[model samples]
Every structure is written in C-alpha cells, then in structure tokens.
Target: MHGKTLTFLLLLISIACLDLLLTHCGRSDHKQKLQKQDTVLLTKHWESPIPHQEIPEGLTSISAASCGTCHAEIYKEWQQSTHAVAFQDPQFQAELKKDNIITCLNCHTPLQNQQEFIVRGFINGDYKTPWKEVNPHFDKSLQLESITCATCHVRDGQVIGALGSDRAPHKTLKDPGFLSEKLCLGCHNVVDEASPQLVCTFETGDEWNANWAKREGKNCISCHMPSTERPLFPGMSKRAGHFHHFPASGIPKFKDREAGRLESMEFTESPVHPGYSPGDLLNYQLKIKNSFAGHNVPTGDPERFFLIRYQWMDASGNILKEEVHRIGEEWQWHPVAKKISDNNLKPKEERVYPFTQLLDRAGTYRFRVEVTKHRMTEENARYNQILGEYPLSIEVYSKQYEIAVE
Candidate 1:
C-alpha cells in the first residue's frame, strides 16, 4: 500500500512540471509575436529613401533655419507668424507660469510624431500626463520656435506637404491632407475632460466643420493660409503658394483687417424726429452682419469675447448713460455649467442690438457704439493673474451720431 501511494505522488509532480514548461513556452512565443509587430510598425514609420536612418540623424531634429537655406521665402513668412511665437507669446507664458499646468505645453510644443501629438491621451479615455523630460534627440536650439517647420513638414526623415514633385536634399512625401482641414483639426478641436464640464477650449476646427466652410468645401488653408503668387524655393519659378501666417481672431495687429471683413453696421433710429427734448425716450437699432468669418467672430479660445458698448455722451465726452451687449460666449468657473451663455455670431449670422435711452439733460449729446474685443472676462482674468495684469481689451469698431437736445 505504501509503494502504490508513492507512485501516485510522483505522477502528480510530473504533471505539474509539464504544465509549467508549457506555460513558459507559450509566454515566450507571445513575446516574440509582440516584438515582431513592434518591428513592423517601426519599419513603416521610417519608410524613406534612405533605409535604416536613425531618428537623431533625421530632419525631425533639424532646425527651421536648415529649411530656410533652400526655401527662404516660405521660411521668412513663417518666421513672422504667430506660430513662430506660440510658445514665447507673453500671454501664453504668463498663463503657463501662473496656472502651473504643464499639460498646456503639449499643444504649445508638440511631440515630433504628429499622430502622438494628436492622440495625446490614452485609449481608455484617460488623460495621460505628458513626459517631463525634453527629448535628447530634438534640436534644443529651435525649441522656442513653437509650432516650428518640423511640427508640420518633417516626419521620420520625410518632408510632407501638398506641393508637387521637387528635388530636395531629403525625401519628400506629397500628402494632400496638408491642404485639407484635417491638418488644423488635430490641435484646434481638442475636448478636455479635466474641466468640470467637458470643455472645448479651441473650437475652430469643429466650428468650421459644422458651418458653411464644410458645405462649401472651403478648407482652413483657404482663409487662414491664403495662397500668393511667389517663388517658394530659391531655384523654382514663381507659383501659387500658400503662406504660413495662419491669421486668426486674437492677434492685435490683425484687428483692423478682421474688422474690415465685417459688414458695416446698419443703424436705424425709431421716432424719426430730428430733435429730442429732456425726459424723451429714443430707440436706436444696430445690426452687425458677420460676412467674412467662416466660423464665429471670436472662434478659437474660449476666453476670447466681443462687446458692443453703446454710450450716450455729452459734448465733454462724459458718459451719461451706457449699455453693453456681448457678442461672444460668456462662461464662469466653480459650480461649473457647460456655458453660461453663447451669443457669439456664427458664420453669416447677423446680430441686432436695440438700445433705448431717456434724455437726462437737454444739451448736445453724442450716441456712440463701439465694438471691443476682450482676451477674457473679469472672472477669468481674476483666476488668471497674468491675464488680469496684461489684459488685452481693444476697440475694434466704433461710430458716433450727434443729436441736438432741445
């Protein structure tokens, strides 16, 4: 009986050993399959004229100045653009330091990989914290040239664009996607779940897609990066080429140009009397037609807003009575709702503001209407210390009508 029991124990031990060996071999096979898959992906990423090229030796790490050597004209236009100063912009830097939210840097100074930059978070819908370490392979000297030439053109040693076959020192891939809205949407249509409400901080891409731009097949490049007849490369003949300026709503220098795009304010006064007396009520109507902006007037940043302020002023320019009508999204934080109100003028949208003021005193009174653009609201300014300190509020449009009060 003892001998039989000992044989059974040995058999059980042998079975356990066989199971362990099989599991080990299975794991090894699985690991090998994963490694093979990764190798294929890497090969596809580095598919250029020069095979087996290391990332350190690739154009991805090259500075924009290197490209300027061949394409001087295009480079010059890009140098003066907002994209050139995106990371170094005073307002952006101030907000970054004040908020201490390092995640903002992801979009400001994006990764070399366009796909990785676009898909910032994880597949599980979780927000992945960006890597704190600067890439050793990147050109440190060109780090501040935010949204640099490499951001859009260079990808794994290949230059991607919408241009035709051209002989360059490096490999070129003519990607039509560069001409489409897809190129801009990657960074512009971000939806952040970190906020109490899922906030679309930059909604230009979404707005363009949903508005007349999409229906009319008008891409972002059509308006923001309009084509100009000029020589792109040193040896190339003059051709229709798009500029890299990427003009949008916020830049102060472009305020006049943007204002000019709006249809002139249509004013209509009720009780068509030539003169007014004390305690008399007068109604004034103003219509602002958004004829130019393919999207909303203040499109990109959520904090951006516009106000149409109507004031009744005396000959001394003292404001006697005033009323402000906002024409942009109004929001508040803490006990956060999606949006407090959104009166922003949409594409081809017309907004009307009617003002009625009672004559307080009999004298020469001037009725003035001014359109002002604000970087952010007072509540947002309070939260963002830098914004409050360097607030960007400018009058974009203004008009006045003098009425003699009897």
Candidate 2:
C-alpha cells in the first residue's frame, strides 16, 4: 500500500511539471505573436498616405543638381560636405560590405513620403522598419548624392526653410524644426536594440541636449552650419543664411576641426626628489587642454580614437623611453564589453598625466608629445580588414620640449 502511494505521488508531480511547461511555452508564443503584430502595425502606419495636395506644375521632379543651377554658391559648399557623398563614401561602402549593414542605408539614402513627399525618419514616432518607398521623382544618376537638397528642404512641391518668402520660382514653406536640433536627431541619435548594454551607437544629439549648449540656446547648426551672406538664387539679393556644408569632424574640409585646437601643454617637475639626479629618475606632470569643439572631441563613431604618444630621447635623438596614452572610448564586441575605457576630452576640458621614468644614463633629454587622430584602433582596423587600406591617422598635432640635466 505504501509503494502504491509513492507511485501515485510521483505521477501527480510529473503532471504538474508538464502543465507548467506547457503554460510557459504558450505565453512565450503569445508574446512573439504580439511583437509581430506591433511591427506589422507600425510598418503599415509608415506606409500610410499623407493628406493629398495638388503638386505645383513644372516642379514635378527636382534634384540637387537642379537646385544647384539656381543656388550655385550653396551647391558648391554642399558638394564638399560629407552629406554629398553619404551613399558613395568609400569607408561607408567598405563597412556595409563587411558588416552587411542593410539598416544603415535607410539613413544614408533615405526615402520620401509618397503623399507629401517629405523626408521620412525625422521624428521619433516616424522610425519604422522597411523604410518608406524611395522618392519616385529622385534622379537615378544622382542616387549617390546621399543627403541631397531635397532631403531636408523640399516637400510637396515647395521649398522648406527656417524662414521663407514668396521670392523663389516655386512655393515656400517655413519649418521651425530646421532651425533646431530636432532636424538632426533622427540619424544622430541612434539606438541599437541588439546591444542592450551599449544601446546608443551614436548620441551626438543627446550629448548636445545634455551639455550647456542647449541652455545657451545653441543647437547643432550653430557650429556645423555656420551662416554666411550669399545669394539664394542667381541675380538675387544676398542674405545671411546657413551654409550647406554641414562640416563635422571627419570630412576633409573640417578635418582640423576634429582634433580641436591643442590649447597648451605644460610640464612641471615633481616636488619630491629621490636623491638620484633629475635625469636618473625623471618625474613630471603633463597637462593638455582642448580649446575648441562644442561637443566631446572625437564625438561620433565609437571606432574613432585619439592617441597621445610621448617619447623621452637623449640629445642624440636616441629613444630612451616611450609610452602611449589612448584617449576616446574603446570597446570590444566579441566578448560583448560595452566600454573597456573612456578617457576622451570634453569640450574645453583639460587632462593631466603624471609620468615617472627611471633612466640608465644622465644627459640632456627631449620630451616629445604627439597627438594623432585615428579612424579606428589597430585591432578594429584588422578586424574590419581596412588596416592600412584607408587613411589611418589623418590629423596629427605634436609638441616637443628640451630639458637640461646636471
């Protein structure tokens, strides 16, 4: 009778476990189904038609080149910008091929809303998968013109701007967002759901908001799209308006701006001496300051880095000691580390490094400090197979000081 009781208890326990397992599986399946439904709903909303409007005649199809015909000066500035070659950039092309980054293309070569024909993906709610259809009127030959004139300024057969007048060949519409950070957040504030720990792949817009720039009423355009007095159209009146270059760190026209100005480098001897000669046991403090840049230096692209290399050499130029201090955030993906170390400089921030060196001989020595901007770390470059294939250290700033010892 006791043996039968034990068997009956075992059977009851097995049945309970089976029931729990089935319940858990059923909930999981339901959750997945709901997620799918949400995605479908969002995608449908993205494809929905905008309010109908009669497009102006003779303005059916317009391209950046076509705009350039009237706005020649603005066109020249934009031609040299990173936005001009957004889609055809070699680095972008290589990265796309290496990582198979299909999602990035939407931001690089964006589509337009079919009804209003405005650029999509500007607001937070506008973010959707299977991006809106490519602009039907887009020129095939100008496909490489990544953020073209129409990307931000054209909508529904009308030219949009911060302020518009009835002076152009086509209708004009005023958009306040164009004058603020709202226009830049869509692409600049990217969140990678796959990287739960490092969800923000790029946070320039967020950084701007957090910094004093927002308090001072300064926006991304304050520094990036500086205004100049230029003619908007051929034989038109010159007016103070923003340039189209939109210069940022990496582009050639703004390369020097990336590193910011190295304000000052000072070396001070240590107060305490170890009885040995100054040359025998060297101790000093090195401080470097960044005078420019509204945001953090080397702000975008986690792969980009700034390296500070210091070398102690004898009068004969023979290296006695060398050390390298790497600034900027360093991350690893294989082991899934969000950030290994971040020593990057903030705008107008100063960083100091203390050094102690033990030398074998005593003589006149020279301390050389070289700051270089690298597109990516050696490890990242090797992983991407782009090491030495592209521009590695395009901008380098250096300083050297000679020290005498008894």
lDDT of every predicted structure (CA atoms): 0.62, 0.60
Candidate 2 residue lDDT tens string, 104-200: 5556665432221333222123232222333555445545677777767766766777756667767778887764677677777765632222233
Model 2, position 233, has a per-residue lDDT of 80
Model 1 off-target regions past 4 Å? 1-61, 98-101, 113-134, 195-200, 253-281, 335-337, 359-361, 387-391
76-180 per-residue lDDT for model 1 (tens digits): 777767677677766677666544444455566664432112221221222222212233444445657777787777666677767766755567778887747
lDDT of 1 at 127: 29
List candidate 2 stretches off by more than 4 Å. Answer: 1-61, 112-139, 194-200, 250-284, 335-337, 356-364, 404-406
- Model 1, residue 96: C-alpha shift (Å): 3.5
RMSD of 2: 11.9
**Model 2: which ten-residue window has the lowest total lDDT?**
122-131
